[model samples]
Target: MSDNVLNQLRNKRNRPTVEPRQDALVPKVQPEPQTEEQNSPQETSPVPATDNPTATPADTIAELQAELEKYPETRRHSAIVLEKDLDQELTRFCKDRGITVEVFLEAAWTFANADNALLEKITTEAKRRYDQRKRVGQIKRLITMLSNSAK
Candidate 1:
């Protein structure tokens, strides 16, 4: 082998591999500042509170009644039944807690709406018991069959 050829081979083997530059791999992010005018209440027209401080309970009830009239009478009757039961439950719970029915109802609504795990657990337990009963029935049938075969 020629000296030049051997040197060339050695140089090729020893030379470090060049990789492609990756400056573009990292993105440049610039956060723009929010303007004072954009943050101002005037820029976003202050939403006039539709909450009427002066509206009496009677007025609120009348408005609700009007809204309820839009639905069928059967729906209203069902809603009344649900409301009465809710009220009764609230009253009972409130008496136990030494609090007012209204306060207890508000708390109970919050609690019931927050998590449905209790409901799910109850249903699951009921289903498990039903399945167990079915299994017991199958075993009883098997025993009955064995006894008949022996006779």
Candidate 2:
């Protein structure tokens, strides 16, 4: 893009500039207490096409939220607090990177939900490290004893 176009784009919005915030706007993990019914996936039937622009606040909160909860019985819905500047930056970043936040979130959810045997892996690693330390201590003692005898 030409400098003139870039300048125009930048000046197109006369909104007051917000100070850069330090904290990245990310989705906060809010684990809700799960009930039995909430463990099932809600079967959201396909909604037919409509000529409504989803970009605006014209859609009711309840209506938009309803679109989020598909299998409410299987999983819980999380409410997010979005900081406006952070949200805009994140959106631009995603667009620039050609990344789908939903896909990444889904993959993350799948990994988190899977039985990854994390505890077992941690335990095995701890034991291995402990054994290595013990061996190193023994080797140090052996070297000290041999060196003293040689001296």
User: In model 2, which range of ten residues has the least summed lDDT?
Assistant: 22-31
The backbone clash count of each candidate, in order, is 0, 10
Candidate 1: residue pairs that collide: none
- Which candidate has the highest TM-score of all? 1
The CA lDDT at 47 in model 1 is 38
Candidates' lDDT values, in order?
Answer: 0.64, 0.63
Please give the lDDT score at residue 85 for candidate 1. 72
- Writing each residue's lDDT as its tens digit, candidate 1 over 1-151 gives 6999999998989978799873332322335577976775544324332245355556657766887999756322222222457668867877987997545545665775667986577568769968887898899999999999999
Tens-place lDDT per residue, model 2, 60-148, is: 44555777776444454575434478678767877887885554556655775565686467568769968887898899999999999
**Quick one: RMSD of model 2?**
20.2
Alpha-carbon RMSD of each model? 24.1, 20.2
True lDDT of residue 12, candidate 2: 86
The parts of candidate 1 lying over 4 Å away from their true place are 1-115
